[model samples]
Target: MVEPGPSISILAGGVTALFAVFLTFYLRNQWQEIQSLRAIQTELEQNNERVRELAQLLTGDLQRQQIDLPIEVPPGTKLEIRYVVSFPSSLSTTAFDQLKHSGMFLRLSPETRRSLFELYDTIDRINRLRQHRERIHFDDIGNVHVVIDPSELDVEPDASVSEDDLSAETRRRLSDLREMRRAMKGVNRSILRLIASIASPEMIDDLELEPFLGTAHGREAGHESNTESPRSDEVDLEEMRSILRDVERESVWSRFM
Candidate 1:
């Protein structure tokens, strides 16, 4: 067997050292990336929890109150309308803001970055809705009631509630609240999915919301696909639908002092 030359031995040692250095740096970088993901996951989890709480508050408290449009207040009863909204701006965005400002967010894959942006964007949208809701103002349609009574509820609604009454500006505020509530629910669901994706080894594409497409809303939204038959349980979403007095009669009550 031929003996190796000194020059060959030196070259082999140099290559081995270089490979070791590269592997060390590669592993360190991977560890750091995991740490960063954990930090972001923590912030997103908090955002999800808080938004879920807000959704619940709206769903529960709104059940106790009712403000159907063309709001007719009988003599001596008061109409009290209150919107309990939790603004997202108040929540801490430290981790997310840091990620964005440091350009770390840009480093993520297209699907991941898009999901993260969507999560934060939903929060921002709810905040904007809350702000816009407060600005909603309208001229009084008729007598304004400060409080409501069961006897007041018993009075027959004026059959002639006009289209203009249904379109009153005051109702816009309530509608905005409804939007915020819906967004709050959806955001948490997205966040949960995002969190799950983070822990998952496989990368995910964007999630598409497939709302029930068997109602008038389906046609209005321009969805060409329609169901041939309704499901045993059905739900619908319509912002402009004129279903008057949708307040839960069994779950509603009002008080005044």
Candidate 2:
């Protein structure tokens, strides 16, 4: 039942106008902030896309033009590879025949070649040790060191009374060493075969490689010009092997234990 006074009405109208003005300013500020956030989000997405495009250029894709390598492997060492739906299990028998026939070993960068050679050397050493153990006579061999020669021992002459007794064992070790050498040669050939396979399209099945290749091959349009395809010579074999070893160990070995 209170009657409105003129001064009170005028004061109420002024307060109401001030509230509306404040509300309008607040809404405009919020809108501008939203617009700024949208622009920043758009820029980030564009940057991410640019990064992806650059990565694609480093690796090649099967659908795009392929580069031929100059390396030629000797005969009989070639592999016959086939697509295996279940890999790692089929890796042993299913020859990547296409890769072997392609002579892609010629495409191995110097780094990859070095890694392959090192792997071959390790295989050789391990095989030689195995062979030497197989050929030894139980009595003639002393220490279990598979490839050690008794004559090479720095021990004093008094350590052994007889020299002729070791001749047979020594000869056996020599035979083992020769056989090991041959087996190692075969292993080196096998590693070369693996490199040849990787150099070809078979490498796409590996993890991260597809994305890496996709980004490297420049398969898409409207991408920034910064993307560069990695030539065969540019790949760091050591780094690739380290990554592959980790992936294999994580995927293959961890399952059994």
Candidate 3:
């Protein structure tokens, strides 16, 4: 019954040991990555908190001064500001244009202000939904495929016959490999989600909501963090306006404007 050059169990043991080593190294690296990401996320949250504080301070200063010393305007204050905010071609950019064109930023009547705020809140909800969809899922599939080099293996006819005898070990190793692949996929998904969340096209419209995205603090934080640039999600509002103004002078938007 034992017609084999090498003992089946012995070979199986060796393969199992090799698989264990690979899995151990892979898991160790994954744990380190997760730890690193957690730290970066914490720092990002702290930076965001600081940004909120800055916004509050600026708002308070404006409010306090407004009450004590009202702003002086000329006899007929018919002020009109026109500008463009350049954005990368993305769904978020389209959404931002739509919202801006909707007169959301204009000084509207009291009823319109309430409606704009509601619309703003709805946009936020949509953004959150998109982020949630981007999260890691265990069963997720990727388009990229990995090809194993079967030519690297030196297989003898006898080795092939004994493979069935070591079926238990083979099954175990294969299962472990499958699990490892799944775990790695999850990690990759999470990383992609984080990147997407920071630079997601859907978040473009949020820039015009209340607190502008990519402020000085955000830019500094982006430079400090390895994760994302501070202006990763924002359209350069002022710069866009300047470019459009120049374009207008060149008669680019003459037909529309």
Give the per-residue lDDT of model 3 (tens digit) for 50-168. 32333233233233322122222232232221111121111122233343343222423464334334333333433343343233221243222222222222333333222233345
Which candidate order results from sorting by TM-score in descending order? Answer: 1, 3, 2
| lDDT values, one for every candidate | 0.41, 0.35, 0.34
lDDT of 3 at 68: 24
**What shift in Å separates residue 64 of candidate 1 from its native position after superposition?**
6.1
TM-score of candidate 3 on Cα atoms, chains taken together: 0.24
Q: Is candidate 1 or candidate 3 better by lDDT?
A: 1
User: How many residue pairs clash in model 1?
Assistant: 6
- For candidate 1, list the clashing residue pairs, or say none: 78-145, 78-146, 78-147, 79-145, 79-146, 79-147
lDDT of model 2, residue 108: 41
Compose the digit string of candidate 1's lDDT tens values, residues 125-173.
4444434433331121212323333243434454332223433454565
RMSD of each: 17.3, 23.9, 36.3
Candidate maximizing lDDT: 1
lDDT of 1 at 108: 60
Clashing pairs in 3: 84-241
